[model samples]
Target: MLFRMRFIPLFFILLSVAAPQVVAHPHSFIDMKMSLSAKQNKYSSINYEWKMDPMTSADIAYELKGLKPDDPRWKQQEAIIMANVLMQDYFTDFYYQGKKVSFKRIPDSYHLEKDGFSLIFFFTASFIQPLPIANSHVEIQTYDPSFYVSMTYPNIQQITLPSEIAANCNVSLQEANITDSMRAYAFSLDKNDTVDEDLALGKQFAQRVDIQCP
Candidate 1:
């Protein structure tokens, strides 16, 4: 049964002290890896990278839709998102776990493509994170700096905290769990950081999420 839309921690995204602001997205989990290649006019093939085995792929297939509250696919998304939040909170409570975060590394890159105004997050793990990619629909508070919205290829946009979100980035998936389902992430502007470090965190988070799906 569809319960009351309890977006308690879903709508507002409270960044760390470095990014002292909260925002929302019309689409959940906008940031994800995917691979895609068109074969003439046929349906272009797409897949998620985290699908290391067979079981996860079967489960993630439906939850990534981020459909309506009562839509048949809503429950699936909810379960996956819920599981992600639990995992994140668990690891985030203290500090770093074993391998930095908790995601597993895979050999394949996720196959993805553009769809209308969303950046579709497809993976071999059996599920896809339906993202609106054409136009930017994200918002950043004034206190936050360094923020960028990408309308191009994957790993294209890099938004910094304290940086105002463009008028284009004004979307937060009203249908999906913003905190758990969002592809967007937060980080500091320290030069000491590396892309792979962030990638590791993202991978761990994604891995945690992939395991949550029923």
Candidate 2:
């Protein structure tokens, strides 16, 4: 009996070690909106708002439930969440005249609120140097490259530009194309699998806001 008990524990440990990794999927959905404001014909900042689905909100709450905002643990958890998101470049991209624009730093302050059953995140990512909108073409896209979290802009009207720039620019929405090969490859991905090295994969799957000025 003693030998059998020891062997049983060892067997369970080995089984656990040999078990496959749990691949993550899109368990969270977000409805997103973006806005751009200009000052003196230069782009001032880009603002973003996101509303997470109830399931995702509930899952997130489960970990920090019962902890007040003032609690150290609560603050720590919030910091960790922000850090991870920032590490992903806030899941945003911008293009100017066919060249990519990179952010110099992440937003230092943001707002989080619980609205009914959903959790909302609001923040603004500022430009390192204001982009002049005069006679220039620009495009913006927001997406998760890993495909583990699905993001969508439900309303085309959610994208807004300042009144002055609106007159000089034309704005349109471009739907992302998911090719057959990409779809099949994405479907075949498992937990331990990494996405293709093609950095443009996110842009291919991301809805783009195209703006042209003359």
Candidate 3:
């Protein structure tokens, strides 16, 4: 069975005929890379790059095969995907001094490409107003609230900071510490199952990027 979601389509490649009860915690996976840039010590924008897993990429490619770039259907699909991302706030939550920060998506910055068997998505978001970084505490987390998709940064090296504030700002990646019980609960859910909205299961599994400038 195949299931489609906001960002990546979920492909059940490992479905078993004999033991059909087994389920996967996350239907799809995304490897994410991010970079933050500043303009004169003020936070300017964040650039995002996401690489979909091979199986999911293959499924997506097959689904959209034979459609040329100029095809109206192809363009429509891209628009739908972007609209979904916008509804989810681009899967990013940025906070400064405990207050949520506002950003505007750069429409032209959104694009997709293929890298080997993987599909890559690129986008940029600029702050509504360039935020001053001095003596500030910023927390950034990227995640899918539903927990249907798993997003991760393979390493801290995948996150970049601008040279202007690299010296004054200290950055760290804090991985999620999900308990054993939560893990079991997540595994118990089937692809068709939906958790309560307030649960926000994905947030519990998200890695936080903390930036402190002094």
Candidate 4:
């Protein structure tokens, strides 16, 4: 029941000068990976799983025009628009050995510090579609715990964004806004029990996380 917060403005659109509009939300990640184990001589790693919605070009147009889907501007930008829409699915629930591990996100304003696994959300120029990483985001690590943390398995594989799922494949363009959302979470298999064991470990992970989006 605990998750981390995120508000690191991964991308910047400057929707409008007078209004200073921005279209990026805090929950936008399309690519993901899982963790596996290798100590057993098998090629496997363990990582929490998460899914997101496919970004729609229509959404980007609306954000840029500062209007709803039916707005006239949407029609104008419809044909000449590029987008990097993302949606969420699930999160890592538990680890194998009951070590109790988890992750979360929080929201905040534009602020990014240089870190090892910083994913810079950049905005790309597509003829009709928008790439999600064109601007300047500060985070993107394929590893479950990212470069900041070491992997626990011997077959730890480095995950990354697949090309086929990219936005600038069929279209001809360069650059894009690279932004991401905040995810706050923790670990503990207390939920799988028969409702008799007290899940205190999960709460411990929550206690370790503090709001850093503000």
TM-score of each: 0.21, 0.77, 0.84, 0.18
Whole-model lDDT values for every prediction = 0.26, 0.67, 0.76, 0.23
Question: What is residue 170's positional error in candidate 1, in angstroms?
Answer: 23
Global local distance difference test of model 3: 0.76
lDDT of 2 by residue, 27-140 (tens): 346799888878888987888888877655664555556777777765665555555557677788898889888765767366666677776777777788888888889888
> Pick by lDDT: which candidate is best?
3
lDDT of 1 by residue, 45-160 (tens): 23332111122122333333455556645554544434433333311211111122222222123332224333233332211222222331221111101121111113322221
What lDDT is reached at residue 31 by model 1?
41
Winner on lDDT between 1 and 3 is 3
Please identify which of the two predictions, 2 or 4, would achieve the higher TM-score against the true structure. Answer: 2
The sequence of per-residue lDDT tens digits that candidate 4 reaches over residues 101-205 is 332222111111112222212121111111232221212122222111111112223232233222321211112222221222221112222211242221221
In model 2, the runs with Cα more than 4 Å from the true position are: 1-25, 64-77
Stretches of candidate 4 off by over 4 Å are: 1-29, 33-57, 65-90, 94-96, 104-214
Error of 4 at 141 (Å): 15
The alpha-carbon lDDT assigned to residue 15 of candidate 4 equals 18
Q: For candidate 4, give the lDDT of residue 183.
A: 21
Worst 10 residues of 4 by lDDT: 205-214
- Give the per-residue lDDT of model 3 (tens digit) for 118-144: 778788888888888889899999988
Which candidate, 1 or 4, has the higher TM-score? 1
Give Cα distance to truth, residue 202, candidate 2, Å.
3.2
